[model samples]
Target: MPRPTSRWIAERASVGTSTVRRPDRTTWIVLGRAGADVAVVFLDAEDVELGRRTVGADSWATWAAEIEAGEAVRWVWNDTPRWYAELLAAGTRLARCHDLRLCHAILRDSALVRADADLRVHTDWDATPHADPPAAAPTLFELGAAPDAATGLPEFLDDAVREFARQRTAIDGSTDPGRLRLLTAAESAGALVAVELRAAGLPWDPQAHDRILRGVLGPRPAAGGTPMKLEDAGRRVRAALGDPSANLDSQPKLLRSLHRAGVLVESTSRWELAQYRHPVIEPLLEYKKLSRLLSANGWAWLDEWVHDGRFRPVYVPGGVVTGRWASSGGGALQLPRQLRGAVHADPGWCLVIADVAQLEPRVLAAMSGDRALADAARGKDLYAGIVDTGAVATRAEAKIAMLGAMYGATTGDSGRLVPRLRRTFPRAMALVDDAAREGENGGVVSTWLGRSCPAPSAGWHAAQSLASAVEASGGDETRARRWARDRGRFTRNFVVQGTAAEWALAWMADLRGRLAALDAVPDSDAAPRSGAVFSTRPHLAFFLHDEVVVHAPRERAEAAALAVREAAASAARLLFGDFPIDFPLDLRIAESAQDD
Candidate 1:
């Protein structure tokens, strides 16, 4: 097992697992299918069954709302979209949940768990979440039968109870149960947020989107015809190449054309093409840029994604191996900056747009307990602070050096400048170095919150073993060394990047609750297009990796901004308690997200 490297984790371990305790009033309600009705099993903090009840399909939503209104409870369910989507559409918003699928994935593979943990046993809980798109309307009762095997996850009452028990046992018996507990909670909360984000879709302006596309692409092309600007750029590129009939879209043909034109480039990639001073470079780059926009977020995309004044993207929680969320559809993660103007607030609403500055490095400083790095990142620009420390002569160098140190860059200017950072911030450098060494030796490494990277593949072990044998050839050694270094680079960055993702999740989860607590506006002032539960309230509208946009009534915009800042502070404290690191945001309040 990989040792815990975080000071906060060590401190938490010292304080014992009592820190995992929940509020006294909180109940754990497990819900699953019981024939045509919904089976509900209530448990207290001690994992003892408090009671059980079965509600008919017709009254499930109403009964759930009543139970939610009564006291603090965290619902445990098979899947978030399967259960929560209908609730939100029926105007029921949950405070918290334990998504068995998401949590099982976390605890089962966590490095902190015992190797013999029962949760590690192969089961249906290991199945991925179902792929069906969330229903737009309330269908809790109408969609009657329980999910079949095709849905991926099991939905029987017995399955939920057994899986929940196994997860609790794994956490309770883990080497660092507190950290695993926190990770599971955050992961489950992310599942809830994913569904809610779809429910309260991002406010979008289709007219503004079309206008931006027109301004950039020079008008939407008719079917089977290219836009004017794209066509002109293509014409310029072909003219520069002196091959009027050149096929710019075909890489092989384009390369051959470039070679014939004395461009002598090996490939058509923009970077390789830029190294030469050919007249074709500028227009070729421009053509590729415009072409990407045309295909990615073009007129076709606008017609498909945006509907009823909202863009609802499917968010897949824990979609990345690093525990980061990924978009399953609608290209939410790749929304281009050119279309920012299209993310418009409603008539009576404003957007609180905020994103962290230098988030990953700040996380690295705090997690590694490098007080010098933390002091530099306390309340201002982290790279500028590195410059003040004399680690590098310029802020640009400081940025490059810090990134190189974290990413294991070993060549060029980044490689040359990284030594200065190592000398100045040895503690921070040591953490990644140790992780790299571990990976090079075929060991697993974990993040601050205990999400472990996958172990080395069998091929990796075979190559390493073969290279160590007596009759190993020069070629075998070379390939083995190269693979080791690649794995080292991956593991070196995984700890920092994965922890940074956890911090971001903590930030969003806390902010989600704070925004929910704000007073709702009058129904007349509501942005009714936002959907049933979110129409009258301030809610999260959009989220990238390190940024969030909150759609709020103009009256609550300031409060929402404050909540955004407060949430950053809270997330830092949650991950690295009492550590002097800060996550500063470049925040703005505007009617259009483009203003920021």
Candidate 2:
């Protein structure tokens, strides 16, 4: 809990502290806080207790770093950021780890777990990382101490040991232990990559960002007033409405003004607004775009998030229920193409920008083993391949139909084209269709790699029961049906999306290792702006759902690119294992992360 340091040790090492020896294979160093000292429990690769050493708080990092330098060690800890952040700051890198919190989250909800596994009872492990963990200093499980305030997870040696044992038992006893093990490994690796991505921040050019803002929104405002371009757009909208005093920013007032002007839209949403053929539509849309830019990533945002030419956003891996990465700040995932020019690299260094082409659909192809779909996705442009299948008339129609099939679209062109897709690619269609049915029936569905969807809530069961009652009203039945349909769409996409996330994690983990093995550049040529651990070497600077941006020295750019490609191939093999589906990358090595 306290960064796995020496402070938890009961006593300091003597003047002649000897070197701690380990076996030839991997060792799991379990750490926790106990009173004034750090509790350390070392276990072998088979989970047998090899030895235990309690070091003073001051000597913990040094000891751990020494162990890390030695050979083949995997640190088993309750949380990654809590323990590894300090070591990383001290220029210590961990090659592999079993992150308990992340792995627990995966294993607890896994459909492969037996219904009576002891892991189901550890509700404390269900907590998000460091969400009001026990505040008191944790003691060794042998000491019978309380839970850690920081992690809420069992912090004592006995508790940690028991938890680890339980996890192993669950994994060993699962219906598909291999898939569960792969999911856990990938999830834990993702945890490490998330921290590293934050530490080695994304390269950002504030000057370029400012230039784009000024060009699009007109120069920054003098005080609190709107920019000239935004004001101009608003003026055009007011004039089009024939009411100079109309309040364009207020939804209610704008709606009334639209009604008065015969636009007659129910709401001011962009989609609804596009349906109307009014002069105000264009300017109103422009106004909305500028306003979003001004608020989300405008000048103020640049000052707060971008510093020293790097933008570090907090990445929450497994943040979405479907396992997509989510950003707590800096809008990392929603970066607009217009502003990608701002993602400039350090001098003498370049970014290897690579993203899988059609990641989810290809994942679907592999998991369902639809040879037709896999053949269609054998190369670039999966949608175009679908067109060749004669499922739809054009690539655009193919795109819509595939999306509809995954997302449960019931109306529009997407819905109409879905049936054609079902006929053409029945296996792939049946996979999602079955997931949807299970979700609607309140049965849990799992990803290809065993990440299960959250079970339906009590409210859901109640609604369904009420809908089935003899006294139920029409409104009740309609509401229940809508809820079920909404849930169906979620589970329908979960299998594909979650498996894609697993693939991404594997890709990044492999790439992280490869990049670390690359030769480090001289200090004079180093990008110190990337921070201490990664500044001297080719390290991963950024990662989104299906994409990664690696900052490498000019000379190592090609090697890094090759590493990215090789990692993708390895990840495919690791997950799908000889499946014909190929994950092609739209890769580029550029001085900036701008789209080509």
Clash pairs, candidate 1, are none
List where candidate 2 sits over 4 angstroms from the true fold. 1-24, 34-38, 130-155
lDDT of 2: 0.84
Candidates in order have lDDT scores of 0.85, 0.84
TM-score of 2: 0.91
User: How much is 199 displaced in model 2, in angstroms?
Assistant: 0.7
lDDT of 2 by residue, 492-579 (tens): 9998888899999999999999999999999999998888889888899888899999999999999999999999999999998998
Per-prediction TM-score:
0.91, 0.91
Q: Which candidate number maximizes lDDT?
A: 1
Backbone-clash count (model 1)? 0
Alpha-carbon shift of residue 472 in model 1 (angstroms) = 2.7
